[model samples]
Target: MNLNAIKYCLRQGVVSLFRNFWLAVVTAGMIAVSLAILGGFLLVALNVGQILYNIAGNVEISVFLRDDADQELIRTRLDGLDGVREHTFIPREQGLTDFGYALGDSALFAGLAGENNPLPDMFRVRVGESDMVEALAEKMRAFPGVEFVDYGEELVARLLGVTRWLNAFFLAISFLLAASAVFLIVTIIRLSVMARQEEIGVMKYLGASNFFIRAPFFLEGMAMGWAGALSAAVALGAAYHRLAFSLQREALLFFLQPVTDPEKLWPVFAGLLALGTVMGGLGSLVSVRRFVRA
Candidate 1:
C-alpha cells in the first residue's frame, strides 16, 4: 500500500501483460465480444421501446358532439379535464375533407361533399398518460353535449401489457449475460494464474502477503477489461451509425432509428467500460482466492 509497493504492483501488472501478450489479448477479446452482444441487445431494445412509447403517447380519445350542442360549453368542459395534454376541435366540414383525402380521390366525392357531410363535430383529446385515456373517455361521455367517447380501450390495455412483459424479459436477459461475462473472466484469470503458479508460490515463500501477490494480477485483469470495453464501444458506435443511416432512407424502417449521436451514447460508453472493469476485477479476485486456498 506504500508508494514503492504501489509502484511495484503497477510494474508487475504491466510486465505480466507483455509477458503473456497472447493471453492478455485473448482475455480482452472475450470481454469485448461478450459486452458487444449485451450492448447490441440493449441498443435494439431501447430504440424499440422508445418507438412504442411514442406511438402510445399519441393515443387519443375521440369525443363526438351532437350537432345541436353548444360548442363553447363542450370546449370549456374539455379544457377543465386534468390529464388532457392537448385537444383539437374537428369541425364536421374538416372531418369530411379528411375522409375524402383518405379515399385518395377527392374528386370522387365532390358531388355530395358539402350538403351530405355526415361526420359529427369531434374533440380529439391526447392525454398525458395512456392509462388515463379510458377514465378520461368515461368522464367525457358523461359531460353534457358530448354524444360519445371512443379511445380504443382494448388496444391501449394490450399495448401496456406488452411493454411491461418486454421490459421484464430484457431485464432477465441482461442479468444472465452479465453473469456469463463474469464467469468467463474468472476462467480466463484462473488460467493465467495457473500458468504462473510457480512464481506465486516463490513469492509466498519470500514472505509476500496475499494482498501483495494478488494486487498485480487484479490490476492486469482490470487493464484487459478496460481495453476490451474500449474496443467494443468503438465497434458498436460505428455499426450503430451505419445501421441508423441506412435505415433513414427506407420508409418502412422509420421506427428503427438507432441512437448514434455522441451525446446520447456517452452513458452507454461509461456503462460498458465500468462493467468490463468490474467483471475483470471480480474474475481476478475469484482466481486469486481459489489459488491462495489451494
Candidate 2:
C-alpha cells in the first residue's frame, strides 16, 4: 500500500521471477496457450458473422410468370416499373437445368429436358427503393402475367436471426475460457508462494513487513502470466499464418481468420501483458498474507 511496500513487492517480484524461473515459465506458457486459443477463435467467429451479414445486406425479389402469360408483355411491364433496379429472366428450361445441377447432377429431372420444362419462368429483380419492394412484389403477384412474387422474404431474415444469437453464444464462451485460465494462473501462483513457505516465515521472523515479503512473488506471477500469453499468441499466430499461406487464400477467412493480420498482434500482446500483471499481483498477495498476519 505504501511506497516502501510497493517498492519491496516490485523488487521481490523481479527476484521471484528469476528465483522461480522454471515454474513461472511453465505457468505462463500454459496461460498463454489457453488464452490464445480462446481469443483467436472468438475474434474469428465474430468477424466471420460480420461478413455473412454484410454479403446478404442488399435485398432482392423474384417474380414467377404465369403459364399462359405473354413473356414479352411481362418483361416490358417490369422494365417500366419505377422501383426495379435490375432484372434477370430465367426461362423454364434454364430453371430445370439449374435444379438438376443443384441435385448433384441427378438424372431425375432429365425427363424435363425430354419434352416440356415444368419449372416456372422467373425474374430475379433488385429494387432501388427498398421500402417499395414489398409493394412492387405484391403488384407483380397480382398482375395477370405473374404467378407469384418472392423476395426470399423469410430465408434471409432467418439466417440473420440465427447468426445474431450464435455470435452472442460464442462471445460468452470465449469470456468464460479466458476467465478460467486467469483464475487457474492465479491459483498456481498461490501454490508457488506456499511452496516457499519456510523462506517467507524466516523473513517475517527477521522483522520483514507484509509488503516487504510479498512483492517479488507477486511480480513473478504477473510476469509468468504475461510470458504465457505472449508465447501462446506467437505460437497461434505462426500456426494460423502458415496455414493461411499454404491453404485457403480466400474461403477460410469467411468464418475465422485467426492470426492472418499482423496488425492484430498488438492487441494480443497487450492482453497478454495485462493477464500477466494481474496474475503477479494476486500471487504476491497470497504469499504475503499469512506471513504478515503471523
Candidate 3:
C-alpha cells in the first residue's frame, strides 16, 4: 500500500470509532471490567502464594532425644543426611531456659534449671527444601535415641496443597475471562461490519483489495480493546496502591503483606495491553472475513 492508501485506511479506522460511538463505548467498557476483575484476582493469588512461600521456608523439624541418647551419634547422622541444610543441638538445660524466656518469665523455670528440668534434649533441623521436610523427618525418627520427630507434618501438607489449588483456580479463571472478552469483541466488530455492508459492497465493486477494505475495521477493533485495557490498568493500579498502603499501616495484616513495589506490576499491565490487542485483532479478523470475500 502507498502512503496515500495508508493515510486513507488510518482515517477510515478513526472515523469508524465515531460512526458507531455507543457500540464502541459499550465494547470498551466490557473489556475494562473483565480485565479489572481478572487483574484483581491475580493480585490476590500472588500475595497469598507469597505468604505461604515464606511460611514454608521457615518450617523446621524438631527431633526429641532420650536422656541416654548419644549426642555424637545423633549429630553425625544429622550431618550426613541428604536434605539437611543445618542443625542445632539444644541441651535439656538450654531448652528449659529458652522455654522459660518464651513464656516471658524466666523466673518461672529457674528452680527447674538443673535435674528438675523435664525438657528433653533435641535437635532443631532445617531442611534444604519444603518438599524434603517429610522425608527428612521420617529419617530422623529412625535415628538412634530419637524419641520422636515433630515438624507439624499435617500443616505443611495442607499449606502445599492450598498453594497448588490456588494456582489451578487462577488459571481456570484467567481462561474464562479472556474467552469472554474475545467473544464480546467479536460480537461488536461483526455488528460494525453488518452496519457498513452496503459501503463494503460498493468498495468491492470499485476494485478495492481485501486488505484495503479490512484495514479500517481491524484498526478500529484494536483501538477499542486497547482503550479498555488501558482504563482497567489505571483503575486497578490505583486500587492496588491504596490497598497496599492501608495494609502497611495495619498491624494485623503485617503477616499478609502484599506486593508493594509498583515496578513489579508493570509487567502485568503490559501483559493486559498485549492480551487486549491480540484479542481485538483476532476478533476483527474472524468477523470481517465472513463478509469481505477475496
Candidate 4:
C-alpha cells in the first residue's frame, strides 16, 4: 500500500517473471491469440455493417406516373412530402435509353423503338432518412399518378437481420474468449503463487498481513495484462489489414474502401489493447485474493 510496499511488489513481480519466462510467454501467447480472434470478428462485423448501410443508402422509392396523370400535380405531391429530400423525374424516353444502356449495345434498341416507349416514366425519390424509405414508398403506393412503387425494402430488411445475427454471434464468441483469457491468467498467477508458497509462508510467520502477501502477485497480473494486450493490439492490427486486402479480391465484397486503409484501424487496436489489459489485471487480482486470505 505504501511506496516501499509498491516498489517491493513491482520488484517481486519482475523477478518472478524472469524466473518463469517460458511459462509467462506461453500465457501471453494464449491471451494474444484469443484477443486476435475477437479482434478479427469485430473488424469483419464493422465492415459488414458499413456495407449494409451503403446498400440501404441506395434504396429509393420509384414512383411510376401514369400516362394520364398531371405532371405538375405529381411534382406538387412530391414537394409536399416531409420525408422526401429530392426526386428525379425519369421520362419514358429516358427510361428507354437507360434500358438500352443496360442491354449492352448502344444503337440496337434505337432503331426498333420509335413511336411508343414501353418503359414507364417514374420519379426516383430519395428519402431524407433511410428508415423512412419503406413508409414513404408505402404511402406513395396509394397516391394518385403512381402506377407502381419500387424499393428493395425486403432485401434491406433481410440484410439487416443477417447483420444483427452476425453481431450477436460475434458477441457470444467474444464473451467465451474473454472468459478463457481470464481463466488462463488466473491459473498462471495461481501456479506462480503456489510455486513460491514457502516464501509467502515465511513472510506471514514474520508478521506479514494478507495484503502484504497478495500485493506482489496482483501487480504481476497487471504487468502480464499490459504485455498481453499490447501484443494483441499489434497482431490484430496487422491481421485486419491483411485480411481486408485478401477479401477485397472477391468481387462481391462490400466496403472495399475501408478495408484498404490500415491507418483507420486505430480504434480497434486501442480497444483490444485496453480490453486485454483490463481482463488480465482483474483476473490476476481475483486469483491472488484467495491465496492471500489463506
Candidate 5:
C-alpha cells in the first residue's frame, strides 16, 4: 500500500482504541496482570537459580594422598577424570598451615610446626555437576595413588535434590501461566470483534479488501498487548531491583543475591513483548474469521 493507505490504516487503529476505551483498558489490564505474574515467578526462579549455583560452587572434593604417592602421576590422572573441572594440589606443609589457620592460632599447632607436619598431601578437585560429586569421589578412590576422597556426600546430595525440585516447580508454574494467558487473549479478542461487528460489516459492504478491513483490529490487539507488556516490564524491573538491593544488604541472605541490572533484562523484556504481540495477532485473526465473508 501507499503512504496514504498506511496512514489511514494507522489512524483507524488508533481511533478504534479510543472508541472502545473501556474494552481497551480491560484487555490491556488482563494482559498486564498475566505477564506480571509470569515475570514475577521468572525473577524468583532466576534468583533461586543463582543461589543453587553458589551452593554448587562451594562444594569440592578433597583427595588425600599417601606420603609415598607420586604427586605428578596423581595430578595427571586427575586431569583426565570425567566431570573434573579443576584441581589444586596442596603440599603436606601447606595442609598443616591451612589446618592451623582453621584452628585459629599458632598456639593451636605449636607442637606440630614445620617439618613436624603430620598432614597428608592432598588435592582439592572441583567437579562440573553437584549431583555427581559423590559418584566422582567414589571413582577417585579407585584411581592409583589415591588414599581417599571426601566431598561431603550427604550435603551435595541434599542440595541437588532441592535444586531439582525448584526447577520442576518453576517449569510447572510457567506452563500454567502461558496456557492461561493464551486463553485470556483469545476470549478478549472474540469480545472485541463482537463489539465492532457493525463497523466491520460496513467496511466489508463498501468493497474494502479483507486485509484492509482486518488491519485495524489486528493493530488494535497488538497495541493493547504491547501496552500490557510495557507496563509489566516496568513493574517487574523496579520490583526486582528493589528486592535485589535489599537482599544484598543482608549478609545472611548473600546466597540469595539477584540480578538487578535493567540492561541485563532486555532479553526478557523483548521475549515478553514478542509473546504479547504474537498472542494478540493470533487472537485477532481467529476472532475475525467469521466476519471475513461479511
Candidate 6:
C-alpha cells in the first residue's frame, strides 16, 4: 500500500477506537489484567529459580576420615581429582572446636577436648560444578581411610527437582495466559467488525482491496493490545519496586532478593509490549479474515 493509503487506514483505526471508547477501554482493561497476572507469576518464578541456583552453587561435600586413614595420601589424591575446586582439612580437634562454636555451648563439649574428642578428621570439599557433586562425592568415598561422605545429597536433589517442576509450571501457565489473551483480543475484534459490517461491505464493493478493508481492524487490535500491555508493565513495575524497597527496609526475605533495577526491568517490559502487540495483530488478522471478505 502507498503512504497515503496507510495513513488513511491508521486514521480510520484511531477513529474507530474513539467511536467505541468505552468498549475499547473494557478491552484494554481485560488485556491488562491478563498480562499483569502473567507478569507477576513470571517474576515470582524467576526469583525462586535464582534463589535455588544460589543455594546449589554453595553446596559443599564433607568427607570424614577413618582414624587409621592416611591423611597425607588422601590429600594427595584429592589434589589430583577432577572437579575438585578446593579442599580444607579439618583436624578432629579443630572439627570438635568448630562444632562447639556453632552450637554456642563450648562448656558442653569442654570435657570432650584433646584425647576425649570423638569427632573424626574431615575434609570440606567444594566442587567446581553442581552437576558433578554426586560423582565427586562417590569418588571421595572410595578413597582409602575415608569413613563416609556427606553433601546433603537429598537436599540438592530436591532443590534441582523443585526448579525443574517450577519451570514446567511456568511454561504451562504462560501458554494458558497467552491463549486467554488471544481469545479476548479475537472476541473484541470480531465485535468491532460486526459493528462496522455495512461500512466494510461498502468498502469491499467500492474496489477497495482486502488489505485496505482489514488494515484498520488490524491497527485497532494492535493499538488496544499495546496500550493494555503498557499499562500492565507500568503498574507491575511500580508495585515490584515498592515491594523491593519495603523488603530491603525491613530486612525480610534476604534470600529471595527481588529484582529492583530499572535496567533489568526495561527489557522485560519491552518483551511484554512486543508480545501484546503481536497477539493483538494476530487476533485482528483472524477476525478480519473471516468477516471482511474480498
lDDT of each: 0.83, 0.69, 0.88, 0.80, 0.80, 0.87
Give candidate 3 misplaced runs (Cα > 4 Å).
1-5, 62-150, 206-209
- TM-score of model 2 (CA atoms): 0.56
Pairs in steric clash, model 2: 9-215, 12-216, 13-215, 13-216, 28-228, 32-228, 218-280, 218-284, 222-280, 226-276
lDDT tens digits, residue span 6-79, model 1: 99999998988898899789878878988888788778777867777677789989899998888888899989
List model 3 lDDT by residue over 1-294, tens digit each: 799999998999888889999989999999999988888888888787678777887889999999889999999999999988889999999899889899998788888888888899999998766778998999999999999999978878988788889899998999899899988988999999888889998998999999999999999889988998899888998999998999899999779888876676777788888888888888788888876785
Query: Can you write out model 5's per-residue Cα lDDT over 12-116, one digit (the tens) per residue?
Result: 888988888887788888888888888888777776776777788779999999888889988899898888889999998778778878888746877886678
Residue pairs in candidate 5 whose N, alpha carbon or C atoms collide under 3 angstroms = none
RMSD of 4: 4.7
Write one digit per residue (lDDT tens) for candidate 2, span 14-70. 776777677767777678767777766755664565455444546778788878888
Residue 254: error of model 1 in Å? 3.5
State, as a TM-score between 0 and 1, how close model 1 is to the true structure: 0.76
Candidates 1 and 3 compared by lDDT, better number: 3
Name the runs in model 5 displaced over 4 angstroms. Answer: 1-9, 66-68, 77-85, 96-120, 128-143, 202-214, 261-264, 289-294
Comparing 2 and 3 by TM-score, which wins? 3
**lDDT-better candidate, 3 vs 6:** 3
TM-score of model number 5: 0.79
Question: Listing every candidate in turn, what is its Cα RMSD in Å to the true structure after a full C-alpha superposition?
Answer: 4.1, 8.8, 4.2, 4.7, 3.7, 4.1
lDDT of 3 at 286: 82
Candidate 4: tens digits of C-alpha lDDT, residues 1-294? 689988887898888887888888988888988888888887877777677667777778889888887778888888988889888888888777887888987675786465666767798888765667778888888788788888887876786678778889989998999899999999999999899999998998899888778877777777777788788878777766677667777677544645454464677778888888788778888988866665
| Clash counts for all predictions | 0, 10, 0, 0, 0, 0
In candidate 4, stretches whose alpha carbon ends up further than 4 angstroms from where it belongs are: 63-149, 202-211, 243-258, 262-264
